[model samples]
Target chain A: MTLTGEFFAFMSLALVAVIGGVLLLNLTKVIHMVVALVFTFVSIAGIYVLLSAEFVAVVQVMIYSGAITIIMLFGIMLTRHHGEEAEPKGGGLRKLLLFLGVLGFGAAVYLGIYDLNFEAVPNTLHENNTEQIGISLYSQYIIPFELTSVILLVALVGAIVLARKDDEKEGDKE
Target chain B: MSSVPVSAFLALALILFCIGLYGALTKRNTVIVLISIELMLNAVNINLVTFSKYGVNPSITGQVFALFAIAVAAAEAAVGLAILIALYRNRRTVNIDEMNQLKN
Candidate 1:
């Protein structure tokens, strides 16, 4: 409500994030779009810090902005893009309709959250944020944490299998 | 953003999610579609962390949930990109509509 440093920080970060998303949508070059999204990802990290989730903010920086963006760029490089994605002529009508639909959905959600105020409870999440996450993750969330590792392993194996060149198929091609 | 209302954070998430949804639905490129999905997930993370700080029962749980979400999202992106590469190799195209075949 009142002018505060936190308010300015949030405003600037959110503005950059929104601008990055807009650029991602509007950019013609596929690589440029992904690059634009780095701004979004980093600003989201700033937002995370503003929300008093320092550990999550660091993770957002490391994982989302760092790792995921690199993987996306790799994905883009591996695939052959024709500069811009070709939208067929006359699909503008459908795009416009989709835009309107998305706008309507956003408006509906906005109305629900516009007056949604929660009384701020004092939480110890900020003090030793990383240690809090570690304790909780190793204690109450141990099972899910173990499950995540398993999931990552499965995804790793599956990706290799899917992306590996088919020797027999190549032989068949010859 | 201690002074900023919870609604503002929620609104930011909502806007990002909408942008992501629209991009995913309309983009022809498979990579961009996947990126859009990641953006949607990021928006969800914002909501989770927001509620963690400002909810009726604020605690560390919401942030823990967000960590799990990030892990899952990373795995999903890896698999999705792998699938995209494989599809590109077989089909020689990256457009989503062109990938509408079980067997050629």
Candidate 2:
């Protein structure tokens, strides 16, 4: 409850994340939202570090902040959006209803979970976290790990198939 | 090392989730809505890691789940954006409200 260095670090990171998320929601420009999203993802990586999940933290930064942000930028560019009004605004009543829906869901979850007290386990990873994660992933969870790769392959193929323009139209015209 | 309480992270995830939910629900732009969905997934990652650290059985399983979630999220974003680009090529706009061709 009292102030400590951990508390300060967590507070600052959490504040940055919340602010970034808020800005992402309210920002009028797509590029601004992507930047805010990067800020939020980086803050989440910091939180993962705080939780002692170093491997997850690294993956978060690499995948979420680095790969995902760049891909989104590419998407925006390829889609050919023009000028500053790229982000369209929602209607007032719809916005109010959406806000209320989110508020209600958050309140319900908080009310359900607030009463339960959680005891913090001291140092979940006794050895190297990356080693432990690798061992577990390769040994016990190998099926899912391989399945994930397959999923990625499928996604790659799907994206290429969907995004590539068909050449049949030119052939048919000839 | 004075440990931070589990409730703090939980609260943070809650706020992030709600913000994401609001954006995903109300945003007119398809790309922003996709970004909002990523936000919600990140909130779930925070919760999973928090529980893995603080839970009674504390193990690497939750972290592993988070890893899978992240991979899946990346794939989802890639595919979603690809689809969005395809739609844009045909429709020339990214507004979700105007894409009412399926309403017939």
Candidate 3:
């Protein structure tokens, strides 16, 4: 197949996947929402394959679709409310405003891209992709990488602190 | 079948992203909102990979960054879900508006 044909095929598949994602996201139920997200991640991985980043594409599937979504599912299970009713009605006006805001944001991004001259940068991807990333992360971006770890640590600690409650009721004894 | 244009892929991604953003902002359910955020992030990854394919000689940076994004997203999911569990235990509700004890 010609290069153009290949590109078209990939793009069409991506479009279908994205539409499915949207459908899943709009559903009110949490389980279906996460399932749709799996489709979205897999499709985006296809985009990575089109870009010739095979390793990244595989990693996307393993990490996102495999790990992250399962975590979310467990969270849903853990937090399942017993005999609770459906969610209350949210404000329609607020939803309309949010929809408008996103539309405006998209238009602004499109306009910005339209006006600006995008000079395509050459040699954007390194041959030894994973090795280069490791070098950059450890050598140049070490501090920020470490900071991210610290942030995750803090988040972990915070989660524990917030979840734990003292069992003793001192006021009742008084 | 022929491959689609880059612009078409981007357009679809943008639409998906916008819908996710709207859902995230408008939905009161915490779980739903989190799903929307995931949608937005995936849209961004699509753009990065698409540009990497057609634009340059070496096209791996986008993919590398995407990998990192996925890792961070995993951590985020774990923490966010833990928080949701904690919140549910306390308030017995997952609606965003109701957990307003910190509101001034």
Models sorted by DockQ, best on top: 1, 2, 3
- Once fitted onto the true fold, the runs of candidate 1 whose alpha carbons sit more than 4 angstroms away are A165-168, A171-174
| Model 1 C-alpha lDDT per residue in residues A1-174, reported as the tens digit of each score | 998999999999999999999998999999999999999999999999988899999999999889999999998898888888787568889999999999999998898899998766778878999999999999999999999999999999998888886646788899
TM-score of every model versus the real structure: 0.97, 0.94, 0.78
Interface root-mean-square deviation (Å) of every model: 1.2, 1.7, 4.0
Tens digits of per-residue lDDT, candidate 3, B2-102, equal: 14555655676787788788878776778777867877887787777667655434345566567667667666766777777777877788878787878
**Candidate 2 chain B weakest ten by summed lDDT:** B1-10
lDDT of 2 by residue, A33-132 (tens): 8898899999999999988899999999999999999998888777766534343454777777778887888999998767656665566474699999
Q: What TM-score should be assigned to candidate 2?
A: 0.94
Supply candidate 3's per-residue lDDT for A25.
46
lDDT of 1 by residue, B20-100 (tens): 999999888999999999999999999999999999999899999999999999999999998998889888999998898
Off by over 4 Å in 2: A85-90, A167-174
lDDT of 3 by residue, A1-174 (tens): 256756675766676676767766466567777787788778777776666677777888888788877877777777763323255476677667777888999897776444333344555353666676677678866776787787778767776665553223323556
The order by descending TM-score is 1, 2, 3
Of 1 and 3, the candidate ranking higher by lDDT: 1
